[model samples]
Target: MEKARAEAGWLMPKTSGYAACAKLRRRGDYKEGTMDFFDECEIKQSIQRIDELLGSGIFDRKHIGNVLYRSAFIDLLICLRDLMFKCRKFSEPIRFTDDVVVTDEIKHVSDLVKYVRDAVCHPDSDAHYLEPGNIRASLNVLYGKGTLIQTGDFNSVSEHDDDVCFFIGRQRIYLQRHIVRAFNEAKDKLLPLVEAASQKAIAESIAGIIR
Candidate 1:
């Protein structure tokens, strides 16, 4: 119940990247024909999908064993992976941004995103289709810490007493928190940087034409 409480605490209202960018576009905050414009738009679409899946009541404790829940969880993981792993188009821009400091927190969150992406993509190598000793060892490494059911061959997100864990299919990863944080990183940090760069490029192009 404590973990549940913790999970519930972070569900405050969040602005959608899609809506924010749409409003900005309507206001002509930046030019329309920039790569950053489309990149941010696409990234926001992924983030919005992630938010919808997480907040759609699919991960309720009652739905833990449901097939639909499993499918939705897989979808959530894929969305997260695609955002950070596949769609890191803004990383280089952020790296060169003079005003934005890429802090350790950002680094850690990115690392966790990559870890889950790898885990989801290569679960067989990590947990299944390996020798018994190897399998148990890998499971222990993944979801065993601070959990009662650390060394089994289960494949769902399970909670026993206070500990929540994933054996194969899902994750002990606090799915909501990780997904939200990643979404914020993209929406808050990377999106702005990209948008600024796009505006600058657009201004330079316009000035060159005027000159």
Candidate 2:
């Protein structure tokens, strides 16, 4: 398994994603609220944190119960969405190696990420309400008929075995099948951009000193 993972580029990084940015931070070359600061601190750190979370088994329902797992899943979705937003702001068209069209109907992973995050964050706005004992309830988000739906009413959703699907707002999403794969592909594409930005910061610092 380790060999296969290494071959597949699934091995963890020797250093945190912030390693490239650490040089700038150490020299005080970039201050807070700057692009350099955001690149080294927010963008790089977020990718590293996502990597950690994906491997932590927290997203696995067997290891984590209903409420906590859903919370973690929603948080992951939010993080991915934020990362995409930052990437778009910092660098246009985050180039993915493969087609990231998550669903046959949805053209981009960003659409799903935004849709899920928005739905979870503002459920009331969409008239999606959690059940009375939401803290202990199992949830799942289902994509169907060109719309995403959440229902605490299990009978209304497709009958899925708990082992295969992750529960969120009475909907089921397959963790490895969707989230993890998309994250890995995204991280791979984003890392080079982060590294290039870090190098650019270093170059600017050198040029400033020369001037």
Off by over 4 Å in 1: 1-38, 85-107, 127-148, 152-171, 194-211
**Model 2 ranges with Cα > 4 A deviation:** 1-36, 90-106, 127-138, 141-164, 167-172
Residue 29 in model 1: lDDT: 54
> What is candidate 1's lDDT per residue for 28-116, written digit by digit as tens?
65554444444644566777788888678766667676777656766776766666643355453212212111244334545555555
> Which residue pairs come into collision in candidate 1?
none
Q: For residues 55-101, could you state the per-residue lDDT of candidate 2 as single tens digits? A: 77775546555556666767787777777776566555343323233
TM-scores for the candidates: 0.50, 0.57
Top lDDT hit: 2
Would you list the C-alpha lDDT of every candidate in the order shown?
Answer: 0.49, 0.54
| lDDT of residue 188 for candidate 1 | 66
lDDT of 1 at 16: 42
What global local distance difference test value does model 1 have?
0.49
Q: How large is the C-alpha RMSD of every model relative to the true structure? A: 13.7, 10.4
Q: Which 10 consecutive residues of model 1 have the lowest summed lDDT?
A: 93-102
